[model samples]
Target: MQVFNVDKEKTLNAALLILNKLGQADYHKIFKILYFAEQQHLKNYGQPLTGDVYQAMPYGPVPSFLYDVFKASENQASPFSEALELSKAFTVSRKDKIPYVSPTREADIDQLAETNIEAIMASIEENYALTFKEITDKSHDSAWAKAEQATETEMSYLDIAESAEASPEILKYISLQAENHNLRIS
Candidate 1:
């Protein structure tokens, strides 16, 4: 029930790192990979890898902040502009139905844990060849369906945890305590 605060810089760096590792990929594919990584991390660690809010869009689940960063990078805006420029990652063929990302510089991989990177890489390897529709279909799991049922745009971590069915009881107890104390995880 507590809101998790996302570190925009770290999230952007992680996104860049994923793109750098995977080479160029379409936006939808990138989002799907991120979603799968987040799911895996949440299942194992009781927290998401990037701490990014997910939205059940028509296409699939998307990390909302990362999507915004990608859009901002396209417009050359502020932190996103600087980060993408310095990282040499850019979105190409925006007018196309599927925009591709080309990462030319090394990402700040230190921002994320090795486990998270591994999960991301594993997700990429497993589903890289799948088309956008395939990825989207894969993402329509119990968590996404539950969120969609509630007419929720932003998918809840609690819902994801429940769907993953791997959250430790201790963690759930601690989360409940934190919620009761009005403390948010950041």
Candidate 2:
């Protein structure tokens, strides 16, 4: 598996879009929706939507960087500068011991791709109202199970695509993209 850098601006815009679409939602809802949406995008395209890696968490697959960003929005001390930036877009609060995010403004739609929006919208519609058990079961796919017992296990895009049953041709394309991306950054 190759490593790829995350696009924080695109990620922020994507998360904002989800929050705006869902209004105020709990951490589970936001992260789970993102997890599913990323999987769909990986299957349809050779790339992920947010380009942020996912971690197999108890709730399901959570975007690792966005997890930190959400923690930062919650006013927890974080080394990431995006913490404050995320806080500006979403006000995070706790109710009955569960944390929720409320969008402070509309999403930067110009920053999001049409297919990405479609994936997320479908995920929201499908997953937003699922029971905790339903979502956990749905999200604990092969990819998530691979890292389930590990702490903060970072999931690779290739593994995610594999679990989503992406075609061999698509997987090869994603691998090529990863190589090109690594070469560009390295």
Candidate 3:
């Protein structure tokens, strides 16, 4: 399958939107919500909400690029420094070694589709109140389990597609297209 290229700015805005809805959350909670949103979109539409790659982290499936963006935001680094403007968008504080993130600015919801935003909102409603460990435990579904067994940290979209029960014909077509286009599956 051809790996979808994620629009970082759009994804960041979407993440911020979720954070805005939740009021405040730690990294683990934020990542779980994003992962669930991506899984829902992928299962229903054959495409992820953010088009971001996911990895099986110890805590759960994490949107890899978004995780990096969050880290950069915490560190006050380059690209994210300009795009996210963490100082304005969020306030970070440590509570017993875990950092809590709270949104200070409204997310640019214009960057995301209404349907996608709704899906994220639904995910937030469903899982937002769970403890970080509870959310992480819930995320150990087949997709993450499969990725956890892989030698590489990055999980394949094909794997997720399969776990989502995408039609065999669709999977075959994707495989053929990947071969024809010389696209890497993972």
lDDT of 1 by residue, 1-186 (tens): 335666666676667777787778777888888888877777777767877888888788888777776766665664655445443355655545657777656678887788888878888788888886788898888778877776556777766666667657735853775487675532
Which portions of model 2 show Cα errors greater than 4 Å? 149-152, 183-186
- Select the stronger candidate by TM-score from 2 and 3: 2
Report the candidate with higher lDDT, 1 versus 2: 2
N/CA/C clash count, model 3: 0
lDDT of each: 0.72, 0.82, 0.75
For candidate 2, what's the RMSD? 2.8
Alpha carbon lDDT at 123, candidate 3: 92
| lDDT of candidate 2 over 1-186, digit per residue (tens) | 335667777788888888888889988888888889989998999788987877777778888778788888888567877766676777889999899998888888888889989998999899989988899899999888877765637777887899999999998888888776672211
lDDT of 2 at 39: 92
Report the candidate with higher lDDT, 1 versus 3.
3
Q: Which regions in candidate 1 have their CA more than 4 angstroms from the true location? A: 77-89, 167-174, 177-186
For candidate 3, write residues 60-115 as lDDT tens digits: 88886777766666667656444455344666677998878877688888888887
Of the two candidates 1 and 2, the one with more favorable TM-score, higher being better, is 2
Residue 146 of model 2, lDDT score: 76
* Span of ten consecutive residues with least summed lDDT in model 2: 177-186
